[model samples]
Target: MSAEIKQAKCIAVLGTGSDVGKSVIATALCRIFSDRGYKVAPYKAQNMSNNSGVTPEGLEMGRAQIVQAEAARIAPHVDMNPVLLKPVTQIGSQVVLLGKVHKDLSAAQYHREKEKLWDTACGALDRLRAPNDVVVLEGAGSCAEVNLMARDIVNLKMAAYAKAPVILTADIDRGGVFAQIVGTLACLNKAEQDLIAGFVINRFRGDIALFKEGVEWIKKKTGKPVFGVLPWINHHIPNEDSVVIERPEAKTDPVKTPTVLVVRTPHISNFTDFDALFQVGGLAVDFVEHPIDLSAYKAIILPGSKSTRSDLFWLVKTGWASKIQAYVKNGGHVLGICGGYQMLGTKVRDPEGLEGPPGDTDGLGLLLLETVLKAPKTTTISRFEWDGIPGLGYEIHMGRTAGADRIALGKKSNDGLLRVKERNQQACTEFDGAVANSGRVMGTYMHGFFDSVPILKKWLSLLGLNELEPPEFCGPQGRDRQYDTLARHFEKYVDVAAIVKVTNID
Candidate 1:
């Protein structure tokens, strides 16, 4: 909306393959530009992932955009991510258009509506570009997937649309970095190939001097410059994708390491809620799909699910429900967040069939609440308190939930978990989440609760794990520090001058 930033240029960070660090690269550039005193924003026309976040306006968007906006030191908006596809089934996804739920569309039906979606994407891009000096664009998956190329509006096609210069990123640690870079160029026609300005080699392991030949070979093969070879980063960034949960896991021991278990549901969303645990030392987190012996872990956490009912059935079918119950019966701690919070109650009713079939599904019965799926999803950046300690988090869910006794009145009781002071940037007094009389079983709809030091410390104290202490650099300030570190890392290897040259901004 500022006249000063109307002259924004696009710089696309496309990938040679999925998980090639496109999002991370874009995030770094956004910070680098912002530190230089330019107003920068991030844009991704469409994103397909279960991971997402709510904007300050209480609208839904991809979590990656939210992270980038934080790096740029601005409030997140829907235009930064116009279309978000949260896959609910193998063939279908819940389409969120311009920050509101559009509809559930199958793959075939979504493609049929591509023409309209393309218009919406372009409009969002124009609106985003109107208010910044530079808008860093991030591409999804491979930019040169020939089969999906014709229908793909995310990668090369989008770059061509904005006349944005592309910097293709490849994961050298995955092997075949040369093939990934050269083969991508080979697949592109002249016009499409010309859009790409250069390359950024990501996750390069071992000595950089050893890979000089590899860089030169890529440059000679494609007649393009190798912008940088980023060494393997020991530093942590947010989740690249949910596929990371599938990595091999080690055994948990409440006695040895104070480990915790996160039930890995098939439709898990917003697993980034626990990303902080990895940063602060002394604690370990693991995602487990199958029912495991729960006695070894200090606590069990149920994360958010895109389909609450579907994942509820999975909990029962997979015997995880019983396993969790047994863990709670033994006085071990258990916490559920978001959809996982919905699953902790007695029953989940969906008479409108908002999430698939219309029916009632039994919950894990750990809490005294019940949930009914309803219209106009609750998406808010919330400010709340626990035991007089202030905390910040977001609420993104559907329907209403309350104590079974209070269900008739349709009101959440004062006995609920946190005291909410504000939602969606508006002030109001209300109670959120539920807790059992035993206090061992706790459930809340709030995501990122652990980001608050008081809430995290309180949870640890409640679990009687006095030995575990959260690190000081684990909050927003810590995150900002990490962004600076990331910018410094990229600046060391990547050619920022060359990037600015390509953007025509210098």
Candidate 2:
């Protein structure tokens, strides 16, 4: 038989360390390539994360890949995330199959499954490249980990399989950018090192002119192009930190004399959920570190938390539970979402101790319901509405609530429990049998609840906050436009054309 050859033009984006802006840069590159009219796709072979998203096909994958695909203007594929590990316990994770939790396995067991995942990852890349000009693959953590080099699906193996060029990015802001780049290359095997085409120094704050010597030194040592020395700009981009968005530039408007005391629990997920209320017309918002007098704030918002049981335990330990109950008794508004929703119930059953489980435990006794942590989390995007209020948003969680069915406030969700359903139904109209109680407290499992600008404005107007206005921050083009703006900013210093030429793609 004649030898078969695959011509899949791809590139691997590797970072010196975690949170070094690899995701942002990858997204930016996707936008840049897509803007040039290329059929481009983004891929990540494996991801270990708790923040996840539901794809169009009612499956789940790392939320990062979803954001990247959006930047690429393509629908998310399970192949992008061939192997996903969502932490179910401290030492174990739920292995996801194409975006749905397939099995619960420990770290050891999952590592053993990497070889199988390589096939899946390679398949995804092939499919993506079939109709595309390029596939931008993002690597996980540091590619320099010698021990992990063998099992690595992201950098070395992915580069070899896709036969793609590589760009190693080092965070100058983290210091020792030189050492990171040089050390990484030094640690890699001959073949791995050969794959790297060049290096880029990201998140460079202060004067670039002053860093000329440093850049030159790196170029001389590595014998590669210094693609760019990007400066830090306060871009109000939606962050990858699902737990929190960068606190809005420390508002100077008198702190708004927060009328609501929002408790920011450790391990808080979906903190961005309340950005609307913070940006609400007249309502003042302040975060309380340790439980303080709740009598001042008009409402208490319990945002989503990653470790609900652990956070609830913290609330109990810090006496916030009693204080919250007292505030509610005094007619204060209390709200919860997702894990927070689970906390407002009667009891939380974690019989498997998947979430620090020894047994079931009682809740704050606010709502007459019970939550059970079960296999296969409920992750979905749907439109839900209260009997009298409008709703729009997505849902992500691992617990199911029971009891108080009649007392539930909204309509049953047309969507599945943990995946995005078809768009035949409007957003925020499917309530999943949960609705707003016209009493002292209200709760639901919805994430991104305030994304609907009009709905949020209406909700805030009902609370007598009429002065708040949503920022028309981006142009009508949404994130793509903003990404281009960022790209243009990078282009000022980066060899934008050279990067494309090096990759030999659009």
Candidate 3:
């Protein structure tokens, strides 16, 4: 490595705009460097997404970093992502610092508090960089938003703070690759531009030779090396935002395989929980928002949400509530998870105005239970049993639910007859959600319910699809394989030697 390169130990993957594959590139680099026997760690000063997962220590961080951590063959820690902004409203978000809820702030309020948050972010970065040979830093959104640059703590500012060379990534699939690279550089001041070491063009299709002139243009225009032109990789990488769900591709016929539809709520959270189902061979999972005929699908899943009450309000307003009710009434299997579980209850009480206004909202009334939004959010990596089958999952929610009526229970208890047992290091007898007497509808607080192979098999059988074979790998193991596949694909296209030189790795 060059003498100047040896001074740097971290490399920041900044993007020209949001969803331009910064996370994907960072993850690839983490795995690529890790494969070279370097002690690597992934770092993100701040992440704004509802797609999050709890660590083994019960601490929470964005799922993207968690995937990156796994790619680096390391345990995920909250310090990797010091600040997590979960948007609960259009203008406001629930800020999480060091895996705990710091506060809820509006956009302007959050900017005003950037100094304190910046210190925390820097401290986290330092801790991550101290032990690892290389810390792959991922930036948020565009690095050159002039209006937000003064208060920005996640992009070029973070790169400067960490003394890391920046690798700008742009998605060619979005078109205007040249404009994105040149325009972003034009927006940056000279000092900021100096931090950039190179650029990577992502999601390119067709012939690489055709893009030779394009690459030369960027290099000539910006005086930065075009590290690589990554082809559009068709892989199952967990998404960091809900925007992908909004523009899903057209669905196909299930054709003897079981079909499942997930109610795509307005404020969906932890949607990656369904990734396991997507990998199964004989299952078709689709996200549906508008009212549609649910009779074709074997099961309908109500996914976790950041704002349960408001999403439930949207469900009712958009006519999905009545549609789901009719589907379930017609013997269609329905599974409610987390916020979805809360929405299935008789009422949801938010007296502290935690989620929204302090009041009660009418639920879908599918389950005879009531949920009360309370303090001390529950975050745990739980081992549980579903219908006598072993299951593993995590819980991240903001409320406690109980049976609404004792007489309605009949032979069942307040926890209902679904019979779920959760173990968190210590074996504790705790009940989660309820199952209807009809046995067609079930609800649970666990997010990764479908990850359990036995449980998934049983659920498929319940949906009348018993001929399909179980996937060889599911859950964590399956995800690890995906990371490796991603690394190999990028390794073939990306300039690993250049990246190593940039990181000062000898």
Which tens-of-lDDT digit does each residue in 239-341 have in candidate 3? 7864548765327464455778888888988988888788778778888767777788888889999999999899999999999999988888899999999
lDDT of 2: 0.71
Error of 1 at 392 (Å): 0.6
What pairs collide in candidate 3?
Answer: none
* Each candidate's clash count: 0, 24, 0
Q: Over all chains combined, what TM-score does candidate 2 have?
A: 0.84
**Model 3 bad stretches (over 4 Å):** 1-8, 248-250, 253-258, 405-424
Per-residue lDDT value at 409 in model 2: 43
Report every candidate's CA lDDT: 0.88, 0.71, 0.86
Off by over 4 Å in 2: 1-7, 242-267, 270-299, 305-307, 350-359, 374-376, 386-392, 405-430, 433-440, 462-464, 473-478
TM-score-sorted candidate list, best first: 1, 3, 2
Q: Judged by lDDT against the true structure, how good is candidate 1?
A: 0.88
| Most TM-score-accurate candidate | 1
Task: Count residue pairs with overlapping backbones in model 2.
Answer: 24
